[model samples]
Target: MKEKIKKACAIWNPIAGNVRRNEKNIDLAIDFFKQKGYEIVKKATVGPLTATQIARDAAYNGAEYIIAIGGDGTINEVLNGMHDTNAILGIVPMGTANLLARQINIPTNTVKALKSLDNVDIQEVSLGKANDRYFILMTGIGFDGYIISKITSNLKTKYGKLAFAYHATIESFLYSYPVFSMKINGRELTSAFAIVALSKEYGGLFSLTPKANLQSEQFQVCIFHKRGPFTFWKYFISALFRMHDKLPDVTLEYADTIEVYSEEKVWSQIDGELFTQLPVKISIVPKGLKLLVPRTAKHSFPTYKESR
Candidate 1:
């Protein structure tokens, strides 16, 4: 009897991030998986939400593995397209802020990232749900979200990380920092900025929620109790040094569910995409997705054993 050939769907975003070199390796990636005895379906995104549709199509067609070859936002779309399929998720991290990839120890270099897949294993990881959508990274409410809402594709691709900083700096001075409320653990707390994190990496720079873990089915809610440009800058410096949690107005708590609201219109960024209009509900979905993680990322997953 002949064995069945497994199917793998490799999805890539041609225009995501600074992918001049990474885009060239699309063929290499497909061949890499092909050599692994898998039939590969290579697709590129034409615009927004295309990846999701492709992923859903692949899942329904019985693909065993769905590899995301773009950034976090692309990965998030692929994830959303996925339903209750037994397919495992993989990443090739090619974006300006590959925070999700960085947190999971996935290499930024496309060649190295593909090579690293040789020593990988599968793990069912927890995912965060913001309203009806799912996120592998944190949900940024207020400051960061405001920046995301204003960022353009050309600006992001050209300026890269500086694009966000540009908006963040300019808006910090002009915009009024409004205080919002989030209900966690049956308690209502007020804050200017809030981070509901599953992974420690925020904005692909610093660990905004150092205690947050992707493997855990809980969120490390980091809230800034004060509102203002001064407080924002202060918290920025403190978080940079990984000491913001020690500050007076900054507080970090763990929760499974969170409801954020405000009389003022608020913006949010989920895995780097702009999510505007507040009153968003966030909660943890335990063991929601099966992820193909490298052995090098064992530190991020404490309970991860070298089963392979």
Candidate 2:
């Protein structure tokens, strides 16, 4: 563990939800590392400047380790910043939910998560790419995107997990589904809802794609062809329990690349942040990024299971 404590850069998001680490805590973390003769470069994220940019600069400046100090969104940005680069990425779960951290067994306690960094295990992980953007968790279209777009950040901060459910329920009632065409690995199809997952944990620790593996070289693609608002609930339930793979209305496939075309623009989200609309091309970069996991953390793999 001592040998692993080389020069590391800690990139922190100052406005990550409701995390309340005071000046003392930061000082303690910094001091602890410094006493061990580690050169810790602390950089706080300012408004609008993505963590990826900060991470890129850190790597370009020769930082061997890049620690992301926020929620999944922050980690996603950091990952994007260091994409295609051979740099080690670490996480401190400071934002709401910290789904990625939980999945990797990183302690939510800032001190312990930081201490565990000494024994951080490096794992090559897969990422989902939409156009030039990379998603660390999952990407959604159709009804899922509609629900995401409807949820306000203030509400999410105030209500935490319930915010998504509250907004999803309202969107279910008010938002209408859009018919679209999808092509998975060059096979043509149509669907109103689609989920391309790279990891098992969706937004609130729920598994949207039970068989999705972060280390796998493929993406788990789920497309719901049924149209109309009534059909939204059916797919929603399937996604919740990750039992949607075997439904007659669901088309589940594993692929390295997928192209989505729509009669009109389709909404999309990656790692909970809403991005551009589709006619978008999505793909998985197999073992593209090296991530830091706790020493005790064991990576989970997917197995085929019959969904009734």
Candidate 3:
């Protein structure tokens, strides 16, 4: 009788972040996996959500591990396809803002992360869903979403993280401070913008939702009640000092589900990619997916406990 061969498939974006540097590291990663007795298959994404199609097909063919090799956006696509599969998810953070990698203490350096994966811990974590789509990180609505949509691929490729700062600085003046309605826990609230966070980190090195963590079953919602540019400036300053939670106009709460809509068409960004337009219903799917996390990241996923 022939023994079954171990298999792993990597779905990556060829143009994500620093392409040349990422590809160089990716080559090294493939060779390492090969030496570890896994038959590795590489799939490069050509267009938006191409990773999803690749991931699904690979998993269907019995790949034991579905590895995503790029930024959080790339991971988001692969995850959507393989989240429900029996295969475990592995990440190689090569994108500009590896927020999820940073949040979980996964090595941002590809080679280091690859070496660590051999003795990793398996964790089943919750994921947030916006209507039909699933997101691993936080989702931004209103102003931030508008900014994310306006950022072109060419801009991100050239300026990296600076491109976001450039776009936000210019777009903030043009933004109209659109208000949206949200229903959470049977109470109606209005806000200029909101962020439903499943992870503690929103952007790299910034903790937007303090109570959020990968181990938690629910999201830590941050809603900005005030509108206008001045209010945004205040929030910005407060956030830099990590004092925004104390602001009178800001509210923080934990919830399993939230209903959001706007009077006009407002955009949304899920896991750093431009997602569906407004009227999105966001909720958490508890222990929805499997992940291979290095034990060095053990501090990130503390035992889940209900705070309420």
Candidate 4:
């Protein structure tokens, strides 16, 4: 007896970073899947949120798997479309920063990423929700959110990840660091910046929230208590050293719900994309997404009730 072929839709964004190179890699990935007996359906996104629409259509059309073939932003868009459906999520890291891919132990190398698909395993992961939008990795308020708002497509296309660093440096001196209040799990808290993180990794291999687990039903909220240039640099240095959690002004807590409000309107970012303004409620949706991960990846399995 032979196994049945699974249907997969590859979602690619032509305007994503490293377009020419990524397109070649995407072709290779598509060919590989086809050779393995997968019924490949190729879909190229035309504009913002187009990947979401394509993925939604693919899911409705009964695609067994929906593969996002760009960076984290592209993956985020595809996730929004597929979250309400039963199609499994697949990723090919071809973007500037494949944060979620790295978090799940997916290789950055295109060939390696495709090869690992031979032993793919499916696992359910929790997602963070802010009103109607769902985020798989992290959400930011204040500083990081403002940075996302400042990033332009041209800057991102030219400098890639360095665009963030460049903008952050300029924003530190020019942009006002606003204070925001959070009602985290019923307790009131104030911070200059806050990150509600579901994944342990941030900005590639760096771990901003070391204890964060995607399989867990809760989020690790890191609050930066101080404001100003010196404090920002201090926190940046600590995060670079992977010791941000040890700083006195930085507080980490586990919560399933958080409500954020600002006296003055402030920006918010979900998975590196500018989402909405403050005065939003965020909560966890446990086992909300099914991801296709490497079979050998330990964290791909559910870790219910496990600390950290």
TM per candidate comes to: 0.96, 0.87, 0.95, 0.95
- List model 4 lDDT by residue over 50-156, tens digit each: 99999999999999899998888899999999998999998988888888878877888889988877776678899999988999999989987888888887788
Instruction: Write the number of the candidate with greater lDDT, choosing between 1 and 2.
Output: 1
In the range 1-308, model 3's lDDT, one tens digit per residue, is 76566799987788888654557888887887787777999889999989998998999899988989898899999999988888888888888798888876777777677877766777888899999999988888988889888889888877888999888787777789888999998999999889999888876646779889876788999999998877888888898788999999999989989999988878999999899788999999988888878777777777632222
Clashing pairs for model 1 are none
Off by over 4 Å in 3: 1-4, 304-308
Model 2 TM-score, 2 decimals: 0.87
lDDT of 4: 0.86
Pairs that clash in candidate 2: none
lDDT, candidate 4, at 113? 85
TM-score result, candidate 3? 0.95
lDDT by candidate, in order shown: 0.86, 0.75, 0.85, 0.86
- What is every candidate's alpha-carbon RMSD to the true fold? 1.5, 5.0, 3.3, 2.9
Greater lDDT among 1 and 3 belongs to 1
Over the full model, what C-alpha lDDT does candidate 1 score relative to the true structure? 0.86
Q: After superposition, how far is residue 286 of candidate 1 from its true place, in Å?
A: 0.4
lDDT of 2 by residue, 71-174 (tens): 77778889888877778887778787787877777777778877876665577788889988998778888776776676676676667668777777777777
How many backbone collisions does model 3 have? 0
RMSD of 3: 3.3
